[model samples]
Structures are given as structure tokens and as C-alpha cells.
Target: MSPYNALIGGVTATLLLGFAAQAQSDTLADIRERDVLSVGIKNDYPPYGYLDENNEIVGFEIELVRYIANELLGSPDKVELIPVVASNRIELLNSGRIDLIMATLGVTEERAQVIDFTEHYVSAAGASVLARQEARFDQWEQLEGQNVCGIQGAYYNRTLTDHYGIRLVNFTALPEAYRALQDNRCVAMVFDDMTLRQKLGEPGWEGYKIAVEPYEYLPMAGGVRKGDEAFLDAVNAAIVKAEGEDRLIDWEGEYDMPPSDHIAARAEAARAVAE
Candidate 1:
């Protein structure tokens, strides 16, 4: 073959190889070959994902993932929990470092563009202030000039700072943000209500109380790499089963309060369609 023809042939071969690689990367078959479903979780988030007294990873999300692994692979032991932070959960899933993310990931349109989300298993609301006593802010407008602390990437930042006109300070993690509140560095610290309730029920949380009721509700779902229809279906099926039997609610009861009526109603709706 002439040199020009040889070059064209090489280019075509490379293109074919690239397509093959892409196909392999997009399938669940590769996950089985690895023999473990790698899951991304937030080790610092309490009642959701965290290290237990026995130094093992345990929480609501962990239990949910274990259930998924058991239903799909015949054993919950087949999963490997990978600790991740808010900054890296999406990157980890996109880069294939983890098979799925069971973190408390709130589903948003921007996130939907990069990853697929399973049916929402947990419903969340915007962050709210936790106060020391009967004092409270009735509306967002009442928070003007007050110091508010929250985790750096919390969804309530824009509302709290821009809309409410509060001075916001963010910490890298929930513990730090809560500590700022405890230390009087801020009038209130903002975090998820479930987590804040769990914290307040702790031995040391004698003074704090949820200052305002949850303002807005958001559905939370698992994050998976995009375009894996098979894997996504499997995960959603597992979620439906769990929700139908109230397994997620039961699981949460192990460490905290049972799912609220809203959660139960949502789960019931999902179960109806799934069946």
C-alpha cells in the first residue's frame, strides 16, 4: 500500500479502537468483572454516611447500597465503600472511580446533565438555622446582618446570603460549621434538618433547637454515571423494592427517627409505578 493509504488505514483502526473502549466503559459487565460495586459516600455526614463506633462505615445510605448489592449480586458483602467529599462525588462517578454515589446527593438539572439519578430515596429541604433557645427568625428577611454558618457547598448559600441578606461563613464540613455555632462564632449554623436533629439529640446538644421550619423541599437520589441504562435500571429496581417494603424507612429507624409522612407518601407513589 502507498504511504498515504497506510496512514488512512491507521487512522481508521484507531477510531475503531476508541469506539470499542467507549463501549466497554459504558456497560455494567465491567462492574461484575471487578467483583465489587464501588460506592461513593460522605464519611462525615451523620445519619446518612459516617464511621461507626466499631470503625466500620455505617449509615442510611450505606445500608441502602448494601441492599442494592445484595439484590443485584446475591450478597451485600460485594460492595466496597469509598469515602468522598462534596467536591469530588461527581468527578469520582464520571471518572469511574466508583460505580455509584450513595451520598446525600440532591437531584438538580445541572447535575442531571452529567450523571443519572435513581428514583429519590430520601427527600431533603433547604438548610435552616439552629438556635440556642426560644429566639428565632420567622422569615428569611429577619436574618439580616446576623452571622450564619453552613457547610461550604450547601444548597442554601444563595438564598441565605443573597436573598436573605445574611453574612454567611462556610466550613469544609458539618462538624466544623456546627462547632462555629457552638463557639458563638455565628448566631446559627445551617445543615440538613435530619442531621441537625440527630446532633441536637446528642449528649452535648442541650441548648440548640431548630430555629425555623424547613423552607423548601428537595428530593435526594443516588448518582450514577450517565448512559448506563442496565445499571441504572438495576439500581432503580432495587430502590423501588426497598421503598415498597419500607426498607429505607426501617433502615433509618435503626439510627434515627422513621421516615416522615411525606417520605412515606412519596415512597408509596414510587412503589405503585414500579410494580
Candidate 2:
């Protein structure tokens, strides 16, 4: 409303942006001086980041982050893994609560504005619908007006609702959504295709199937505070190194994940560049 109020708001926004820029510009040096790399990650997402039987955090992304820590800080144990949900990972990074985000963060135009991304590492399949084996819908458009389970803050939530006309039943976490699905609270549960595929092999999921395939694939990458050039470059270099060494391929087998041509191609390319 008032002109003076608008001016004050604009000034405050500019100062906040300035502060954020200043904070990130030297993050690489800060991480080294502190002798630790603080990372926001998902401890509830399996094969990416989740707790093992020992209740210790472990996953494909967890190993990657640890590798990065070792490459940058001299030891994998020099990293701190903070569990983060999709809704809060970016906020945690921007607020300086974490130095980086190695969660299953998809690179998108909206997220790019708030945080810079490392090398696009994984060509992850986007949302797909999981339903009972007898369920027939196999296309995104076929779910019009149907209730579908989903995670809150997923990047594809708007597309599922607006473009496909699906009524999404949002949950804060995967376990709750999976629970609601088992109770038949929704027609289908929609989530990352890779993770859902892994679920189908679990003991109780044999009766279900991937009812719909992904409409698109997203490039997943690590997130750092915006304008963190040195840190971004360092992280990217480490990823490329890992690719060159075929570490990603080894991690995939260790995690019991299906092989991906996307990762294989990257590893081949990285080796070529290295030679």
C-alpha cells in the first residue's frame, strides 16, 4: 500500500539478498576452515538417503556426499548429514543452516532461482502412479478427477493437479503416504518412479504395480546457496571425479538399485574427459 511502506519492503529485500550473496561467496573456504561439510540430506528416502538396519543413515546419496567430503575435507567422516524433507531443504541451505543439499533435489527453473545446482548427475524419472495390480489406468490423463497420493512440496504436484486434473492427497512424508495407500485411501500413490520401482520388489508390494509410467524425467543435482561459485565448482569437480572412477556404478550395485544408462553414459564421458 503506502509508497513509504513499499520502499521499506524493497530495501529490506535487497539487504537480505545481499546478505545471502555474501554468505555463500566464501562457503568453500568456510567448510575447509571448519574441517567439516554440513549437508542437508533425506534420511527417510531409501536408496538415496535412509536409515539402515543399524539405524545409521546410509544410502546412495549419503555415500556420494561422504565421498565429496573426503575429496574436499580429507575424510568422509568430516561431513554432517542433516535430515531434510522436500519442503525445507532449500530453506535450510539458503538460511545457512547447512552448507549444501545432496538430497534428491531435482533441478528446476523455480529452484534454480533460489539455489545454485552442482552438475546434473542423475536423469531421474519423474512422478509415476502406483496402484493395485488389477487397476487399469496407465496414462497420466486417465486419472482425471481421481484421488492420488503424493508428497507435499514435490515439484510435480502442480502439474499433476493442474495439467492432469488429479486430486492429490498430500502427505508430509513417504511412510504416511505409503500407509494411506495400503489402507486404500486413494486410488493410487504417486512418487519418484525409481523409488516406487524399488518398493514393488519389497515383500508386501507384490500385489501392486506401477500403474502409470512417468510423463517426464528430471535432472537431479546437489544444491548450494546461490552464487556459491567456488564451492559449486569444487563439488562439481568431485562429482566428475567420482564419475571417472566409476564410483557411482559401484554404489548403484551396493544400494540394490537398477542400473541406468544415464549414469553409464556419464561415467563413460567422464573417463573420456579424464584421459
Candidate 3:
């Protein structure tokens, strides 16, 4: 690169870093002052986060975002729901396009290096390999020779590929992965337990079942940009309070899901929790 171009890039990087730092430093105060909380959530994944028939964003995660907003801004109405998929949620957050992420973001070491995950608000365990019911996955090791469809940027992809020695064709979106599975480009699809279960009941996904269960159980939490301890603190407290008031339980019935015991325990006290 030319010296002038390199200098311009460096200056741009510095400015962006400065903006991100500013965004993190006053996140909590800014939200309160503006009385608005911007949260990025999924609009395609049903049950967890998705769009209603009316095109309004609705789901388990959406309610949680509102609860957090209420805690910080005194009203759930202050929330602005922004649609996000797995690929860009974090980038949007760090770029100051969104204030927080309440999407189904799993806790992973690599991701933790960039963003801060508050105490897990939910626990998940149903990872699986979806294939024709007639297909065989009698032993988990059998997946080693198969080509499996997976999502890009998923924390488990390396495990599915390197550890299991499976050939994985990755897609940035769920729909594309589903398409790949339908077209037989891959023999099976590997993904989260709840989401895969949701697909099982939907039309056009027949003859397929979970042939391989997910190898890892994950803790799902809200994500925010690194730095800004105060914002993180307030969000964590809101999560705890929401859990203690039986709000999470109530949401379960609304979303037709079960309550998470791990999340409930952290609500009562600090106890090295909600960090």
C-alpha cells in the first residue's frame, strides 16, 4: 500500500477506535439520558427471535430486551429493536450502530476476547446433526466422513470439523444452510438444538431428523462492546432482577419454552455472578 494510503487507513483506524471507546464509556448514561435502548436481535430464527405475521419482531429474546430497557430507561417502550443475524451483530455493536445484543449469541472463548458477555440468561444443549431419518448416525464418529451443512462464524464449526474430522460447507445465513441441506449438497446439517427442533416441525423439512446431537451445551447471554463497566453493570443487574421477579418464567409460557435454572440462581445476589 502507498504511504499516503497507509496513513489514511491508520487515521481511520484511530478514529474508529476512539468512537468505539466513547461508545462504551458512556453507554449506560447515554441510554438513560436518551431514554432509548438499541438492541440487535434475530428476526429469522423462530421461538428465540423472529418476525411475527404482522412483521413485528417478536420472540423470547425480544421480551428480554424490553425487560433490560425497562430496567435502564424506566419503560420498555424506550427500546428500539434492530434485526440482526449471526454474521454482523457484533460488528454493528462495535461500530456504534447498536447498543447491545440480545440475540442467541452463545458464550465462547474466541468471542469473549472481543465482546463482554453478561451472566448467561439462558442455557442451551440441543446441538444435533439433521439428516434423513433413514440415514444412520449410530455412532457419533460416523460423521467424520460426511459433508455437513453449518453456519459460518459458529463457535462449534471448528469442533465439528477439526475435532470430528467432518467436511463442513458453511453458510452465512440459516436459510442458505437449509437450502444446502435440502439440495443434498451436504448429507446432514449441524446446528443448535432448539433451532433444529423448530425446523423439524416446519413444512418441507420432512424425512429429516437429528442424526447427531450437538457436542456442546452453551450458555446464551447478552453481548456488549468491550470496556464500559458501568453499562455492563446495569445490564447485568437488570438480568438478575428480571430472573428474580419470575419474569423469565413468565416469558417461558409466552414463548412456549422452559425456564433456565442457571439464570434463576444468579438473580438473588452478586456472588461472583453476572460478570
lDDT of each: 0.75, 0.85, 0.77
Sort order, lDDT high to low? 2, 3, 1
Alpha carbon deviation, residue 125, candidate 1 (Å): 2.8
- Which residue pairs does candidate 2 place in steric collision? none
TM-score of each candidate structure, all chains considered together: 0.71, 0.71, 0.65
Q: Give lDDT tens digits, candidate 1, residues 86-194.
A: 5666666766789898887876665665677988888765566688876667666777889888777565677778887888888998888877888999888777777
* Candidate 2 per-residue C-alpha lDDT over 174-241 given as tens digits, one digit per residue, 9 for 90 to 100: 99999999999999999988879989989999999999988987778998888888899999999999
In model 3, which residue pairs have backbone atoms overlapping below 3 Å?
126-193, 127-214, 128-214, 129-212
TM-score of 1: 0.71
Shift of residue 2 alpha carbon in model 2, Å: 37
Report the candidate with higher lDDT, 2 versus 3. Answer: 2
Q: What is the RMSD, in Å, between candidate 1 and the native fold over all Cα?
A: 10.1
RMSD of each: 10.1, 6.8, 7.1
Q: Model 2: residues >4 Å from true position, as ranges?
A: 1-19, 129-191, 203-212
Candidate with maximal lDDT? 2
Report the poorest 10 consecutive residues by lDDT, candidate 1. Answer: 1-10
lDDT of 2 at 8: 39
The TM-score measured for candidate 3 stands at 0.65
Question: Hey, what RMSD does candidate 2 come out at?
Answer: 6.8
